[model samples]
Target chain A: MTSKSTSPRRRQQPPIALVILAVAGIAVFIVPLIGLLARTPWRDLPALLTSDVVVDALRISFIASIGATAISAVLGVPLAWLLARVEFPGRSIVRGLVVLPLVLPPVVGGAALLFALGRRGIIGGPLHQMTGLVLPFSIWGVVIAATFVAMPFLVITVEGALRNLDPRFEGAAATLGAGRWTVLRRVTLPMIGPSLAAGLALAWARALGEFGATITFAGNLQGRTQTLPLAVFVALETDRGAAVALSLIMVVISLTVLIVLRERWWRPL
Target chain B: MNPLAGLDAHLVVSRGDEFTLDIRLRVPRGKTVALLGPNGAGKSTVVAALAGLLPLEQGHIALDGRTLDDPDDGVLVPAEERGVGVVFQDYVLFPHLTVVDNVAFGLRSRNVKRGPSTAEAKRWLERFGIADLAGRKPGDLSGGQAQRVALARALITDPDLLLLDEPLAALDATTRVDLRRTLTDHLAQFSGPRMVITHDPTEAFLLADEIHVIENGAITQVGTPDDIRLRPRTPYIADLAGSNLFIGTAHEGTVTVGDHQISVADRHIDGPVLAAVNPRAIVISLAEPGGSSRNSWNTRVERIEHYGDRVRLQTGAPLPLTAEITPAALDDLRIAEGSPVWVSIKATEISVERD
Candidate 1:
């Protein structure tokens, strides 16, 4: 049986031309990472990384990205559940609006946020008058901008997982005397834990790498809104070594997160 | 009947473009009723309706005289508050929780603290003979082990009514036989009105005091195991139990079923009676043979079914009945469906019982 199976498997190999094309596809993703590694200033890395600009940018990026992930978990999970489980009018329209950011340009999303929440804009003007506060070019602005662009990853992922779950588990839980809140907290949440974790990681990664939205909606200031991406953008012209160091830091963080979450994200693929 | 006795339910629910389920059931305290039916016969619908998962369009359900559902009066109790414990098909154990935690879930859901709930769950697991599997997740347990955990979880809540849906359908043949004995013992300990839903006649007969045979969203017959086996009312039940039943008037030594008469050894039975003839008791031949048997008929074969070493044929003619023969005998007779054959049954093989 083993010999007969092996013979057919060997005969089913792909053509050499397709194999060559597949190798070229793989090279397209790897060549750029090799280029970045070749240009690194190995000896001056510590000094370049510890500079005041890089340190401040690191702090702001951490705050904004982590804050965005927390807010997304709070708001996105319920939204995903409602979309997957409930039926109401205009639900498709609401879902399409929620997913609009994933396909919309980041600059356009930032501009839309400015129109809705900027100091001189509609809700922002009345709020500013009441609280005597400003929002644009602040640390809060960076978090809001990151959340706007990053939350759809969490929503769509969680919604898909919710859609695929067998509802019989929830029904069984109910028959076991579990109320609605207890059932959701104990059964529904844990069953989707892997997908939730994967969504959070993807959202955090996207938030950490945010550049266009932050620059458009939140101005680039050293300790306020200048995330790693913006700091790298600013240093690319005058300080190439510092830019390389900042890029390397982001690469390391994103790579570590992806590796830690590889099992959850890779299984479905 | 006492008003505050046990479960008394009349369920009428309609699904769009599909069949409407309309069944009336009553189980006194400390009795088991089996809803036996084939697939698509709405056995699950009965479970869902009684458990408060599906509301009835008409009729009312009362457990110990407390109304659970009445569409006319607009009283519908949710599933969690109904106190109906259902062991769903395939168990549906929580995959993320350990065996102990899954069993403890009922108590925890009722606001019992974790420490006490865990202690109680461990005791239940010990009673089920699975205390060693407490820490293992559902994915690590076998089918029988999962079934025990599911039972433990349902019984922990002290429900007013217990429902087991196809409990033994998921187990292997050997495990099913072993677990069935365990299940019988456990079910005897629960002091409540219980219902077992299954398609297997043997399981129904073994586990239930009374059986309700459902077909196409309706109950066709409700009786004891002996009643269903000896006097099947419908062709489906007769075929299921594999008993060729004849209901007719009995004379001194013979019973006239339809246009034909069957001879039995009993000479005193008279009036209406039910006669059962086992398919294996009938002998089939291609040609007429002289024999000591008192009954013989020339019939055509309507259907032929092979069951491993033996073959069962449905005979069509003046006396339509089922006859079983060995495969070698069937080959020697050179018969197929629609072939003419001779069937004979000894007078001593017929069992006569009151209708």
Candidate 2:
């Protein structure tokens, strides 16, 4: 009995069941934020933020996360371009391996890293003998763990953008006397600027919030390996007020970064 | 020097069983050749091969005495080093860059300084009468404007060879007319040999000094536009050139078509011959009152189409023929679809060619 005009009305307002599901979805995400805000020690926030343990963890977190993001940007973008543009034997397999960290548990990723680069590990053993470097239980180890868990975000984002790019532009550039390097540097990268920004932001945020890999591989050290997430975990056992304060700080920082990135980069073309 | 010393190519591109393009063409410097073919007849493949975008399965391509591709010698220059420019059918301007930058891309890639390249690009834009749109993105331009931008981008490289793939196919009728004029001017200014790929015969005849007719991945004929119009070898070319073609075996001056024999006053061809009849030369009548035209047939109107002031009638066969008549004649005879009619044409009107 439905008419065409009424069908438009039906489309304008989704089914009641779907509306209820949407409300439930929002509640699932927003309720946690509300809980964190309510638990925040607002009266003691300033004091808790300035405490020695919080300051040390925050400094460590900043250094490790930014380091991890820098490494990922330098290496991951090229890997993304390769995965998207090249056709070689075992290409699909290489692509799968690049995205494995996104699905693997962070603790397992840390364990795999440990086996490969630990003091007594396969490649790490020769490295320690030659250069006297031991990575596990150190600040560098923390950055490595963060990169293992977060680099995949940047790679996947940039790779998807690269794959969807209209290759005709490259063809046109080639015919216009551009060498392969020039086209990649000037034309291809500049065109995908927004997606690159988006990928960098996602990777940076993931690095900042990394918890399991940092704890498993780097181990908790008060002024070195313990990032904000690890500090929150240890603080929750003895100082609930400090833990809530640190979590609030982390939430606010990430929210501000994401909003800034969206405004600057992801505007509709 | 030989006249065919500009852009010469003989190539075979195989796309499995779906299609294959086997073509041989040449265009001397300051000349334009049109590769005219129907859709899916592999005109684009020829353009791609010439530009070094697609590798040839066999044969070689050379431009201005330099070998661009030769499978036997392993002297295949990459597309970026081929010194060839192309304006794709869709005018594939970069969606991200400004109009001026898109045009200056070629110069910039060759390490020319920014100031000179931008100035040169701007001048080209002014010539295209689109200097006002220099800062605008391609998404903001109309179809005709985009076409001009594509042309400017290609020509800025000063390439030794240029290829245009259906440059006018993406525009509306009025815009196509305007852009076609602009393209003619630019082609005159470019010194290199240029090849234009198009399916429109009017576009080909208007712009090209020579036409290469391709059908089913092979070049059936290569001649001037008038030559192609006067004698179209294939039925597809005949339709495109607006002539009705009848292919049959000939004995002396008589050609056997289907179940009927028509006498043609042409050179005596012993075996198979192609007979081309101008559609306008054939007259239609309600009654059989033809005096001297022994070349007459009884036919029924299959369809009638209006083309400006003329009505073209497609008729049923002993030998199916398309004939054009004045609209007034159409009304006087009262011919509609399925109306039985007599078609008459003099023997001298039919041009015969050895097949």
Candidate 3:
């Protein structure tokens, strides 16, 4: 039945080298996961994950990642709409700056954020003096750093969706006496729901896996600012078993998110 | 001057360096005016301008004694405040909403309570005879059903002006006839100014009270159906009106069109039908010629018009039709206005289709 369903031309065997390389590509991702599984201490996994350092890291990771995702959504959606719809001078420059964090090294982004918002830095000096507050080496710094590195994912996804949407749907709504806000809330946003979901998932995953920016900007304080990746980094130097356990947790989370969102990310909306 | 009662607008908009639309339109209360033009003839531009989706670069638009857009005076009412209900091409219904929610959207946007809006929307669905489809999404509807939903959504807002852009251009031929009748009934019920934008000459002639012939961003002629049909000002309108359309009841192989009866080639069609006869298919002779043709009549020439290499004779009497003949044939027959002529058409030449 399979042979009858597929055309004869499509049933032809692919080239040998192409097949070999495709298998190699699959193996490249699978090999490291297999290695991690081989090294996992399954019986001691629950005890290691429940330790104080691990528990604190888990709480901090959840707070920082979810908080960053919320912030990104609030600020990035409107920024994306502006870039997609409005025509302004230097608009391309603003778009390039939004996308810079994606391709730039995370460490570089952390440094840039530090220079802008550090205690003694340009705006940070006045901010600290006026409010008697500091941002670096705190949980707030972790969220900021994560957002700086992860928000581009959401902005780019939503911008592309907005650009591809038919403007006539919004026009129809407006002609129906819907105000601008109502049209955006009712028509434009719902029509781009799939892409927005995909963008949020991608951004959350990126924030969960963040290491360099968090460690560089927020510092590695075990109970205050240390997150999962920072905990892994600290454990790698002192205890290899805890490091492996943390890595396994991250692997499980990332895999589950990807499996759930595979269709949205890989296919055209 | 007395305040205008309905829509009164002069639209002038320039897009870049290549195209500029400049036209004036006046649709009185309780009248349907059609802006008829072919593709790229600025039909969409007119729709957009009237719906307040695009601002006029120059000129004023006044509806029911109120000014909507006047560029020189810096008065521009945004689309949301224009009180215009538009059924866009292809309907453009929100895919995420159910039929009830889609209908209720206009009321919801006006700050109406959810319970009242839903009840009102359901009543409208019942009025349109689609109450059972209230729970279904737009993607699940047929083309005709979707058009009804679009109409309901637009009309629920109770706007002062209703605009339909190619309302039936998306449906199949069989569905179009039924939907056109439904649309005609709906248009009659709306007592506000209504405008229909279409490229189909038959739709414009049948649906609108006044026809505005637009070409190259300008209106060339404005008149009633018969005036536009018989005294076309441009070659484009001449070409469009050249085909004669007759709606009649068919029995066996014969169709009764108004006062005259004509034989059609399709013997199996036995209901109301639309028959089309091209001007070229009609043969004109000075005397009654005997041939295999089944339909021939003695008629007087009411008008004679020449359109580039061809002469069209507007015949009067028992059957009125325009027949195209070469300039040489006109010289040979020496036929002029008020001349008696014999018109004959083979039954096979008349194309008949279900109305």
Candidate 4:
């Protein structure tokens, strides 16, 4: 057994400081979750979760998050490809701007979205005058807010993956009589399938957890803009049990997705 | 053979540094040209330029009288439309796709239906004897299997020009030998203009009908492998051709090389000349032998390389020489590194050409 210990696969002890900090990190991450689980009204869990307000919020959150993920996939994938492969003037600036929403406070992003698409706002003013359409305080607006904050997760993840992929594959495809579109659809996308899945999962989770932007831009209209996090926030003041149940639901969903994705795709090969 | 003629290109590619490739090449129908050069000698650049991956800074590429690239004429065919199939240095088989799917990609891109495309891809796999592994991804295939698949994929396109970039460089030595024969056979069957980029002279000789020696971004010489090997134009090619070359002034039959005067058989060029002597031509002796061999120099052995069956000795200057002798000769002469020895060469054995 000791002789087998000489093999390279034998695990080495981590540094004491790293071990301490890692344990501390895990404790901080899980402690709130433990508290939420402990405080959950198990007997009343089914009834509380099935309440009209909670169910409606959950439904809205699902629709909005799924919509956001769809939008991100449609727009963010091409943007990621562009950032990873193309070289142009202002490319670095464009890349920095893509990640701005990720670092920018959600409230600020909401405010920016408002200024751009709000009534009597910059683009919104013209849009209203031309089409008489108002985007704010709508389900579409909630999706837009979640997308603004969440698409960056997908974009950055996919971009990093695209950057790491060998561009030679694309070259090989092209030389094999594959057009740009064919190569993108057939070669480039398929090669980065895992990263795409991971990015979608991450973006979906972020959209599901979105609060400040949704509340600010889409307003707190129940069943319309009030998603899971918004519902949790509102319930915390009046119904702690409902809030805990809602929070637990959100946690379970996002954690389940991330865990399954980690096991299937995200783990280092 | 196909109706498509061949490739004719005069390419000028200037990249970041002052490294510019200004070379002209031609690959006739039913012939393969091996672009031989060391790394950074623009071998891959030439392949890319021909395949339309890299745009020409100046000049034009024409295949079968059709202009592929002409910067002056504002004509540049994109890589996809160029009809040039490439087997990249790494073979670059799409890792995500099954073996058959990877082969069918080119056909599918050309708008062939899935049924016919899969059937055609299967045909190629059968040719490569990997039809059983059609469902397997490229990652699961061994290097040799992957190379054959790459060739099959490229050939299925029925391209006007086929480019193989160091096709066998990634395989292990034994696999390389086996695949080299397979590649040579495939090249014979594919009656299109082909170009193979390789740094190994032996690979160039074995796989290609013609050899183009490229060095420092320019084609130094182009000829049959024997022509290039026997009369190598550059020091790099000389080394790659496995010969020791000396550049000096030749007067009458005597050539002065770095203060050492050696006699050559031909009084061909009087001025600056290149003299190439194969390592097998030079003979080493424990003492200077008085004979008709006109060239003799006393030098110390600098290094001894065990080259499988034979030992190659690197003797010290005033005329630094590399000589291959039998191990029995080495043992009989009691030669080791740093041993003083006399090397002799017949004047007729050295080939002289104008520098």
The model with the greatest TM-score is 3
Candidate 3 residue-wise lDDT, A1-269, digit = tens: 35556555555688999999999999999999999899998999999989888889999999999998999999999999999999999999999999999999999888878888899879888999999778999899999999998899999999999999999999999998899999999999999888988888888888988988887788999988999999999998998889999999899888888888887654655
**Cα lDDT tens digits for candidate 1, A107-195:** 88889888988999898899899997777799988999999989999999999999999988999999888999999999999998888
- Tens-digit lDDT track for model 3 on B1-355? 3447889999998877888899999999899999999898899998898889999999999999889999899999988899899989999999999999999999999999999999999998998899999999999999999999999999999989999999999999889988888889888878899999999988898899999999989999999988888777788998887788888989999999998999988899999888989989999999997979889999999999988898888999787898889999999989889999999999999988887
* Cα lDDT tens digits for candidate 2, A176-231: 98888988887888888888888888888999999888888899999989999999
lDDT tens digits by residue: candidate 2, B219-307 = 99889987676555666766698877666889988998887899999746777776878888988888995588988878899878776
- What tens digits encode model 4's per-residue C-alpha lDDT throughout A156-226? 98999999889888888988888888988998888888889889988998998898888888899888889
Q: Candidate 4 chain B — worst ten consecutive residues by lDDT sum?
A: B229-238
The 0-to-1 C-alpha lDDT of every candidate, in the order given, reads 0.89, 0.87, 0.90, 0.88
- Residue B141, candidate 1: Cα error in Å is 1.8
- Model 1 scores a C-alpha lDDT of 0.89
Q: Poorest 10 consecutive residues of model 1 chain A by lDDT?
A: A1-10
Candidate 2 ranges with C-alpha deviation above 4 Å: A1-13, A267-269, B1-4, B243-355
Query: What does the lDDT read for residue A128 in candidate 2?
Result: 92
Clashes of each: 0, 0, 0, 0
DockQ of 1: 0.62
Point to the candidate with the largest DockQ.
Answer: 3
**What is the C-alpha lDDT profile of model 4 across B1-355, one tens digit per residue?**
4344798899999878879999998888889899999999998888889888889999999998799999999999999999998988989999889999999989999999999999999999998788998999999999999998898999998999889999889998768856776788887868888999999876788778899999989999999976676555565765687777676899999999989999999876698776878888999999887979888888999878675577777778888777878899899999789999999999999988665
lDDT of 1 by residue, B1-355 (tens): 5757889999998878789889999988789999999999999888889887888999999999999999999999999999999999999999999999999999999999999999999999999999999999999999999999999999999999999999999998768767777899999978889999999886787789999999998999999986776456676776676667677889998999987898988889888777878888988988885869879888899878776676778888787777778899888989999999889999999988654
Residue B177 CA displacement from its true place in model 3, Å: 1.4
Clashing pairs in 3: none
**Candidate 4, residue B297: lDDT:** 80
